[model samples]
Target: MQETLACFKAYDVRGQVPEQLNEDIVRRIGRAYAEAIRPGNVVVGHDIRLTSESLKQALIDGLREQGVDVTDIGLCGTEEIYFATAHLGVGGGIVVTASHNPKDYNGLKFVREASKPISGDSGLREIQHLAERNVFEATAKRGGYQTADLLGDYVAHLLSYVDITSLKPLRIVCNAGNGGAGRVIDALEPHLPFTFITQNHEADGHFPNGVPNPLLVENRSPTTALLQSSNADFGIAWDGDFDRCFFFDAAGNFIEGYYIVGLLAGAFIEKNGPQRVVHDPRLTWNTIAVVEGAGGEAVQSKTGHAFIKEKMREADAIYGGEMSAHHYFRDFAYCDSGMIPWLLVAELMAQRNQSLAEMIAARAAMFPCSGEINRKVEDPRALMRAVEAYYAQGCTHIAHVDGLSIEFDDWRFNLRSSNTEPVVRLNVETRGDVEKMKQKTEELLRFIDG
Candidate 1:
């Protein structure tokens, strides 16, 4: 067995198939996870990837070998598995998905009861060690496997999060990117008044067009063009496994996730009446401004699903968001979902009688950002230290919540290393000054590249 750090990410197991991750490794992970959690019953689900079924079966075999009963939810998204785990009140759950990675890639995401994420600090490191060691004490009797379809309950739970009955007729374009999101939309469209112009709605493991990741500029074109041509109110797209979602306005412009964060924060605040909201430190001015303006509290947290979920539970926040399109909800046990954001956004539009662009236009000018920029560097920590040293001299405030973040009266920026990739992500925002934001972003990029 080869020892590689790539499979051990901050949150879940992920790697290129048959190299860092394969059937043998996945089976071992299943056994190890079963032993670690020692759940009497475990729920498992898979995406549309070709390898998903095989990997899931191997995992189930390992779990059963350890006398852990397995409940299989076939061909579901990550959030569905989370729903199954919580709704069924099971011991824990695992999702068999690489989540927006290439088809040749596959991985697993584990959670304890109520879909609580498993991290390195929690139980992931132990699982990794066990998986690498490839040794486990066998049980006297093997566990049994049972199949269940929880899609109905999952869909109902999602709809209950938003008031669709009061929504007006709104035309929207949905680009599933040919992933697992299409089925959920199909089930919900009949129950709502909104008209959906769907594209790439098929669930294809090959991802016929490209990977489902909306962060890539190239992936936004199809959804943008479809929204423009259809003159839809707005458009939404999801990555593979449909955990995170992105939105596009009626003008076919891709709205930054930060703006959506503010929108969702405001919506939740209006309904829930000024509660706490959690946001990642990388991009937070808009979120903070919105939450504070609405008489709510804005709590900053480190970037990652596990950290955000933990913060949400601790703060009892109504909602939380990361700039990378991951939105977490208190109602969903602090689990991120690709399906819920748009539902609430649509409801906000219907209730306000305004278009999505109109609602976000005012906030857009309050804080213009250069979007996240990534740089491949040799020493991420050294570069971050240098940037912090440069900015700390004159900045009014600085923080190391996740990485280096410096805040001046008029501008602020955060530079952090990726947990799963060999790169550093830099995000800079200025108080409605595009030129300054651009200049500072360039300066930081140069420093990182140097």
Candidate 2:
């Protein structure tokens, strides 16, 4: 058997199919998870990957073999599994999905009660060790599986988050990119007062257009073109498993998730009145400014889903956002969702009577940013240390929250290595000076490459 610890990632279990993440490994993980958490009942869901069903069945068999009751929520998104776990008050949950990876890749995301994520520190290491040893002690009494359709309740809960009754009947374009978002939107459209123009809405495992990751400029073109042709109020797209969603303006301009983070933070503060908000350190100025201006506390965290969720719980933050498009909520057990951000943004637009572009554009000039750039590097940490040394002498502010972040009088930049890939991610922002931002970005790139 392939070692399971090699496949266990910072936030979830993911690897190449059949080799690193086969049926036996998934089954072992399920049994290990059951034993570790020892929940009376566990909720299970799977995405639209080709191998998802088989892997899910293997996991379920393992759980049942260990005498743990399983509540199967078949054909659901990642967030839906979170909802099922939190709503049912189960001991924990597991979602079978590779989440925007190629069709051949598949993985699992495990969570404890209340849909809390299991990171390397939070019980995942224990599960990994157990699975690696294949030492799950099965109970003599076998457990049974039960089926429940929680989609209706899930939709109702999402609807309750927004004032749908007061929403305007705006024309919106949604590109599911042939993922699992189509089913949820199909159920949601009937309940809301909005016109939806959907493209690639079919849930196809083949993923004809790509993996549906809207972060890539190439993957966003279809959704932008659809928005332009339809002249819709906005366009939304999701990743393969519909865990994180992205947005486009009425004029087919793709808005950065950082801007949306500020927008959502402002909205939440407006309603809830000056609560704490958690933001990752990859990009921080915009979120910090918005949260502080709204009379809310801005807490900076390391860049990862598990870290963000833990910080949210600790600070009791009303919301948390990552520039990578992950948005977590206090009400949603601090789990990220692809569906919730759009709904909240739509409701905000309806309530404010402003275009999505207009509202987000107001902050664009205030916090000009170079966005995020990734580069292949041989020595990421050495490069980061070199940059830090270069700036530490003259820098007024510096932090190593996730990676290296340095601040001068007029400009700030963050250079961090990706946990999953061997690439250094760079994000630079200036005090409304585009030229300075570009110059600093170029200078930093040259230094790193040199």
Candidate 3:
């Protein structure tokens, strides 16, 4: 009730555990969410974080107090909660997870009926205001709580993306990063022909091997080392909550999410012809090329799950992808799934008889990129203004759907501030030229630093 908790982020709830997100605070959030969304029943789930169970229980207490039936799916990922909300006929869903945050941190992701995300522009602001007000009306009937296991259904849904029998025996290194993904992997193993070489595979909120963010170059060594030693076909790593996934080729080379977006776009476009594929603005040349080449239309949407999902649904697109490794499927109720992307990638490779690296190499050559670079700056707005002023003279085009996207004759770049942090992110891509991309990336960094 103290001037709105800082944990309420633009997309979801995330903050340091106990310090910023405690049982009492989460309980208030639960009640506020029920009031704002007015769900008859809500599905609740938690990740492997140590504080998750306690926070979930407190949230359930608040929801039940508000006469909202609570369906508890214990120790699950964000996607699992999304699945439960629709599959179990729950009115809404909440997931207690901080994703790639530290062990001392935790958060929550919310969805309305049919797994529609509730973000800042949607209903999160109202929930924040209500939680801060901390006033609630008593209901005539208090709702009861129940537990359900939706793992089998969730796994079955994931397998629906791939032709299981056509998939050849694959040697895969799956690093769950000591999170909830291992449980899903265990559930899926019996139904597949994959030999999983796992590392830090156990669910431990303590994060013994460090947070499982493959985005951080340092956190990638474990999977890289293990994959090389195991001689696996390819390796995959997921964040704490397992909503996003990172890939490493058979040679233990980390593949950037941008190329994966192109690969996945091509796969979807191949099967679902003329289907629209939504993508984020950052590092888009590759994806656009793939989508158009496959006879599908490419639509650009702002980054973030909420924006992409809404745009995908509006376009009735078959698939949407972000350079950050979040892949959304129209079939998966338009929710992003880390599980489905990998399965699709595996199938694409098998059907095409190509290695993961080989599949990416063709696209990489067409649209080489600088990946995404982040830096802390005092005034991101001022920096972007300077960038525009500097490049405006020769720029051929500029788009600001999510941020500043400037295109010239042979190169383009997008510079934007992080939605959740103070850092400014820069992405540079050149048309079929890697050296130009590298040169432009350094040039932009120098200007930003200055």
Best by TM-score: 3
Task: Check candidate 3 and list the clashing pairs.
Answer: none
Query: Any idea what lDDT model 2 has?
Result: 0.90
Which should have the higher lDDT, number 1 or number 3? 3
As a whole number from 0 to 100, the lDDT of residue 344 in candidate 3 is 88
Residues 115-166, candidate 3: write the lDDT tens digits: 9999999999999999888998889998898999888889989999999988
Error of 2 at 47 (Å): 0.4
In order, the Cα lDDT scores of the candidates are: 0.90, 0.90, 0.91
- Candidate of highest lDDT: 3
The residue-level lDDT of candidate 1 at 110 comes to: 93
- Least lDDT summed over 10 consecutive residues: which range in candidate 2? 1-10
Task: Give per-residue CA lDDT, model 1, range 350-441, as digits (tens).
Answer: 88898989999888888999899888888888888888777789898888998888999999999899875679988999999989999999
Total backbone clashes of model 2?
0
Clashing pairs in 1: none
